[model samples]
Target: MVTDSQSGQGENNKTNENGSLPISRRGAMSRLVSLFLFIGFWTGIAYIASFYFLPFIQIKPGFIASALALVGILVAASVIFMVRVTPTGGSEARTLDFQTLIIVVFGTASLLAAGGITALSLKPPLLAGAILGILIIYVITLFRIIRFTFRSDREIEKIRSQYQDLIKIERAKTEFMTVTSHQLNTPLAEVRWGLESLLSAEGIEKENRDMISMILKGVNRIVETVADINKALSQKDKTATDYASELKTVQLAELILEIVNVLGGVAREKNVTLSFEGPEQEIFLGGNKDKLTSAIKNVIDNAIRYTPGGRVIISLRKEGASAIIRVQDTGIGILPEDTPLMFKKFFRGKNALLLQPDGSGLGLFTAREIIENAGGKIDFISTPERGTIFFITLPLKKTA
Candidate 1:
């Protein structure tokens, strides 16, 4: 039985976080050198056995036994090293340790038993040639194994370092966006409130009222832009539970009606017929109200802007457990080549640019981000020069 003192010493030796004895670069190198020495010693013993003990056994029997043993060892070695090493949980180091054990145990045992028997059973002239061939083969095989092991470890370390750097860069970017969005939101909110107050005053002239209304519209757009930035920032590095505090039940039909009402003037100016269709029974889903409003508003506004004198229809209904919102528009449809990049930030199709050269190309990108974050999906199908249909699907709030 192992003594308690020996057991305690074994436990004390494992100082690494992974419950393994710590090994530095120098210590690993020392182990590698020791491995080479073991290989050399094994080769020497094989040479001695072949030279002195071959006569003791029949040549054919000795050759067959040695061949079988060497084959088994090579198969075992290959199997040991074939396991793919992942970068997680110090697996690379563990693989190295296991490989060392395999090489030392299997290499020594097989060669001591069979290495000389297989090669030395031949005539004297062939004996030297056979020995040299065996040595070359083993040396090359071990060198390749050592090279692959350390090179993979180095590559894994490089990838880990790059991943850490990318994380730092992303966090820094998110912080900058958070700060900029807040700074933009405050001033934009003040401007909107001041504009609304001016427009509401009784003594304001008709022309002045129109101008203030236009300015208010501009301010609202700025506020929406800032809110989009904030939403994008919040969605990064966050989970569903992180958003529980902000989500609330939203009535899909009412929201669609409200967006239609707000965009009515824009549709009229473009001579586009705008309408909303919904089921008599109200459908509700869970999401952030302001963000959802912005998302729907963007889709509808884009429809009106691009449709000109065509019809734009917004509809909402409940299908099983999902609330479906469809915005179908008779507008300049997306080009086939641009489909793959449709929802990428700042991506604009050739047809869309032709329709509105000044478009910021952020509307669809922001819409998808907000909807997806709220456990929803947004997709579209388009036929160039004919029309486009956008579909938004949100999970319906479960009824207890």
Candidate 2:
């Protein structure tokens, strides 16, 4: 009674026992075809050489025997080398198997072809020397090509594997956060009910009542925090799934101007001058209008919130093949140490926390994710006490 998982593991184990790597049906067929073609190349050259040049030189039985012996030695060495270097299993193994076969076939053919040509051209010492020299160079070139090809292929595979592992880890983290938030909401709701019931009861002394009120406030804050977490996670999941389908042509200039208008009042209250700089002509790009608006608004709002009295500038322009959106703020610039973790979730800089205690630190993280999902990237440069500049680039849509 073997389960499907157990059966799959058993199959993998069986493959490992045979070679360092397992080969797919298609890969095996492709390798066989390559081997035949490689052997045919050398065989064809040898046949042509024999037909055209064999009449010129006298043949000796001893020399022919020596050539045969050389080929046998090469074949044996190739077999041993292939066995020793075979990978434990996959595309690399398939590649190594094919390369080893090529090496053997090429070596054997070169030896036979060179020996025949040299033996026939022996009367012309120059021709024999030249033919041997060319064969030697060809062998060296083949060896160098195989060595570099395998090295690069292995390096690429390692990087690709690491990237995939990182993606899986990120997905797991997101799922855990969503589940934890849901669990916290249940307990948080119960706490809120208990607090409200206590507050509704008859007088329980002035000091005790004050303490309970503070405790209730704390519970309410926890509920809000949990709710925010759930919202962010759900939004991230939604954007990840619906990004491609939600895309439409959006005017870059108008979009930023709308965000600027909405946040202008907030900027004014803080004595921060907000301005929009863009060309009159509309710059169009393909993206989800709602997601793009959210992403752009987040960046602009952060700039306004962070700037104490200085101005926040929102600008858009077409730069070559990309639509560049720049948000520059003259604020308490980010600390050098905090710059690296600026866009990471739940990471508020020390300065940011000190200036604005209510900051959630999720805005930048969510903004970056949305921007990137829309085929754009955000980058920034900051100098403490001077200013910070954020650049968001999206590929421009081509028009007829």
Candidate 3:
């Protein structure tokens, strides 16, 4: 049984927002450039400092060059050590701290030792301080490189997590849809058989009329089940950007009328009047046409299912920034406890199940998912044995 918590826009929103990190290719390239540039600048500065300070030792020029070359090699080795010891892409603070410590220790020690030797004849405090300052700047550059690397790594991990979650949710939704579709097949076959039998009957008596009505009800159920499954599948694949497509701005009133016409015969059989009461004006909502139709069908079907000998009223109107669709039914209304779970997949009220034992209990859940995915909200006001009214509010699409 798929629960509402396990299959809806709420889950989708949470997964998209929290489970993924958004990193761009441009950002990655910039970080890589910054890292290499930092390393190059620091290595160059360290080499220059070694060349300048070696002459203070009062050695022969060739010997000073050889000694400075060796010192430069040591400083290069220290930089390599710092890079190696730095953590590979996590929190910047820890990597920065480790790199800073390495640079301070190795850099200060190298500068002081080199200065001590040079000071033997020249005793140039200014030269020593300058070397130390160069090393400090190198350390700072290294810190920037480490921070950028960590941030890049974190962003990559985030993208990976987002894809993983999207896959999981897609799989779960597919499984639920497949299972529900399979479940629907049996009832649909039964309804088809009943309808065929009614068509084959010879006499048109009151008793036969009752049987025909029952068959019609079964057919309605089959249709509703199919619509719910289709809606679920559509919602599973829909993204926010899809709303801007040409298919989303079509007329909604006509779609509702078509659905009502399909189910009208079944409603008549139950003596439950199903109808639409709204403006003739075109009400276009920003969503997939088939998906919105299925959503509305689910709500209307649910109304017809419970409202024995009563009426199911559907209305569509423009209100503020939203298109309001209301499905009100004079049925054996929901209990307070059941109201919360009414939209949960595979969940049915006690009275509802008693009335229709074969209900897959996925209609309301699927409807809610479809509505929410299309940037809408579905809510209800109900009391047991009184009636229920579901208000579906969706954003309106403006067109020239």
Candidate 4:
């Protein structure tokens, strides 16, 4: 909107960017009165201007009442111009435009006519009464403006209080997730390491070994998930400059395969066919392996949970500077009304709420955040009854 390089000078100099007078009712009444005393300066100038301009009229300050009457008429006309030119609405609506230009021109002319008429009127006492009546009317108008300001202030206070409470709640949620994730990490790692040692041991029986292997896989998945949560939560205080801070090389093909293996059980229970379509060779990139794994896992889990008894396809393809991952699902797709807020925190569609009443509803929200912080984007489209398709794009690392 600010397409031109410009600055204000001369009589219209501004103290702030938007050029509004700084007035508040909180200060002492005396200080407030003194701050707005520029009216005295204008009055003095008006009085002086009268002498040079009114002599030819032959109506001295102490000589006529008709001239005073004319001054009152002009003052009323100026007030009417102000009331009409003042546009409706809040601060933004009050900005000056063509209407403001008209007001400034007509109002200035009316005020000058009033001043000249007052000077020509020789009856100083009559001119004094005319000014008094105009001041009284303006005082009433100022009171109304003050009352509106008070009402606006109360509404602003309510919004501020609500905003502060929301901030506190969010901070608490982040702190709890970060702390709990860290606490769980230690024991989870120990369990994983212990299982790995046992599984690699010599002469283990086949049946017991199979059971241990399954447990180990589950434990390893949990550990990876916990690490991702801790890492994501820990970045709450970080900025865009912290992207890939704890990153390492990750193999996307193997990662998605592992996720498919883990969610395969859930897909079977739900009678949903889930599969992937991509190249056989691995797609390697620089990233935090655990975090990216968790993000993709969230998408797959959601797909399995929502599909009544259908198919979900996750496909990968490389094009230009990026690799695209698409997760297409045959599910109770998002309600049309809820599609816009899909990535909003804890926002579940009506169908989702009905399906999983206890669902935390932070899946896509967390997933999008992780992918974006790792310098990628996640987008999705959904229809009410048919299906949903999510698109994730990550920059492919350049070969040296």
Candidate 5:
């Protein structure tokens, strides 16, 4: 039932799927093997010229030995061609440039001319002329390579331009998603507030109360969907930020308290204890406050969502020059296989899907982007049925 285009797209998507170590390793091995083969070919040519040509030359032993040695040096120079040819990975545009081809030709000519002139015992003028011609060809080849290097510089500039455009597009997409989430939240919040007010009225029937509860749950689902989309959009923009100037001294404890307050109601509804446990001392770190806050909130929100009735703890402390933020929860932990993919967009573990089917799976991905952009790292430890703990460490200063 599938067309060729559809099938090809499926194959391309499969090729791009994450964590395929075997394929990458095979590619590296193939490159190494190719390099060895090229080296072997040059070595064989050098051996032939030294063994066969020296006996034919009528020149003195010293001249014959010098010619043979020069042949070996010429063979070694052929290896430099590898620098000009980049691996195309089977792409159509992959090819050797004219300069690369010229380098190979000139190197081969140099070795051949040296061997042929010595073997033929040609006139001194003819031998000198031939050697001079080979030298001139090599000089021209060198000039060509220099010109190609300039071309490559332009290509690099073009690539940078494309990267900037991609950044702009990502920023636009994130801004749109943020606006959309805000718009959706306004209506959902209004409806939920209206329903809660009506539920408080006296003499409301049990049936009506159950209907109101279902409506509230539906509203919450919509809010969560919007949140997921916004999180993904935020992630796109997070990668584009200039981290060096963005990070500044910010209060750690206050940020954690603000995030906990925002998610407090959600925790209360799930009968989970959400609390902060760390030094009350002022902990300051060089970081973008808004991005850091969002990242920490996402971690806390995740903990609250997975933990049914257990405790979720948010801790902050300074370890030397780095700030360490830990979020620990007594919840259904992640599987070993899924731990590495936890921060990847749209990835969900088995237990996570079982607990929350409506999750869009972008929370941790966004959190990772935020932390990484602020020159920090995020890691987690989890065991099934025990709990999960996420650790975020950020440098005290942005190092150049």
Candidate 6:
């Protein structure tokens, strides 16, 4: 039977398989520490040799200023050496991991050398004892560094393994969300179309019609939930590349008119009159074309969904340096309490929720994401029972 430590060594220690003694990483670190200890001890011996000679050497008038200039040059050289030794990962590299130890040891040695130059008249025996004390302190500091380095190496190994495991777990989660969302969406799409057909049919009792409407609403809600999951998972997959970089001149009026046409079915279903008025001159700007289109579409779409048998008027014009998009809707409007959370994800106002129970609560949130990503602003004005107006203001990206 093998002991636990031997079994762990058999699994993790590759050298154990070759019939040789396993050398732990700590052994090499100890050897490196011994070399440093010898260097520091030898430095104290040199300090003693310099004591008598330093007293005999005559002091020159410019010596202090020249010495200060030499120190400044050395400090500048150390900074340059550190920058050159920096790894490809840049400033965060571990090239200067032992900087504190180096600073302490170098400063102590400098103090000892300077003290020897000043304390030359002292007796040899007392001078030897003082040097011994300094060497003892230096040896202790080296030992402390060896212990810290050993522990830190172990911690780094542990963190590396944990980071790898975390990556695998996150990938598994993204795959699961993507697969399930796609599976649910297929059947939900069929159900949505079937409900729309049923709602359009004639010869149904008023009581039964309400029941069908409720069932259709519930189906729509499930579809929206599935869509939210897909969108959430895709956001995790999108990298910095998906964000806008290049710009193209875009006509805001043309885009708004196209969105109004696209949402026509929903407007007709709700008996909401939707219209768009363009500016005198074609409003041109530079932006991410696709993202801006989605932003404008979501805003107009929300206006149609919440309004009950009313009109929505969208107009575009310039306000000083910005192109203003004014969307006025005769909807349920928002309550004062819910006003602050207007653009938050999955946060529907009390009145909006009561109007369309199937609302995903992502419409305004997505709109904000798109507009802000393109460097624009969205604001709103509302009354409790009257109506609401949303304003989208974007700085005109000028063209030559």
**True-vs-predicted CA distance for residue 104, candidate 2, Å:** 12
Segments in model 1 whose C-alpha atoms lie over 4 Å from true places: 1-75, 84-135, 138-142, 188-223, 244-248, 286-290, 357-360
Name the candidate that leads on TM-score: 1
* lDDT against the true structure, each candidate: 0.68, 0.69, 0.69, 0.65, 0.69, 0.66
Clashing pairs in 4: 59-120, 60-121, 60-122, 61-121, 61-122, 61-123, 62-122, 62-123, 63-122, 63-123
Weakest 10 consecutive residues, lDDT, candidate 4?
1-10
> Model 1 — which ten-residue stretch has the worst lDDT?
2-11
- State the TM-score for model 6: 0.55
Candidate 1, 292: how far from true, in Å?
3.5
Candidate 6 or 2, higher TM-score: 6
Candidate 4 local lDDT, 304-344, one digit each (tens): 88996999999887756777788889899988788768776
Pairs clashing in candidate 2?
20-87, 20-88, 20-89, 21-88, 21-89, 21-90, 22-90
Over 1-400, each residue of candidate 6 has an lDDT whose tens digit, in order, gives 2111110111233333333434333222344544554464455435434444444345443543444344344334334333332222223334333553464456356545544444444436565556556545544544444455555567657875676676679778779878988999888899889878888899988888898899897887698677665654544333224545656788888888888988898899899999998899888878877768877888888888888799999989897778888888988888988877888767899988788766678777777766665667787878887788888877686866
Candidate 5 lDDT, tens digit per residue, 1-400? 2111110111122222232211220111233554564555445454534433344444665665666665665555444544533323333213434445656677667666666666566536565565556655654554444444445546656865676676679668767778878888888888989988888888999999999988888887888778777767745634435655676777788888888989999999999999997675777777788878888888899999999999998888777777888888999999999876787788888999999887888888888777777767788778899999888887775346
In candidate 5, clashing pairs total: 0
Residue 192 accuracy (lDDT) in model 2: 87
Error of 6 at 78 (Å): 11
Error of 4 at 372 (Å): 2.0
Model 5 TM-score, all chains together: 0.60
Which digits, one per residue and each the tens of the lDDT, describe model 3 over residues 207-317?
877878777766866676675566556565566566446345657788888999988977986799888986667777666777777778888988998998999999888
* Superior candidate under lDDT, 5 versus 6: 5
Candidate 3: regions farther than 4 A off: 1-13, 16-198, 201-234, 242-246
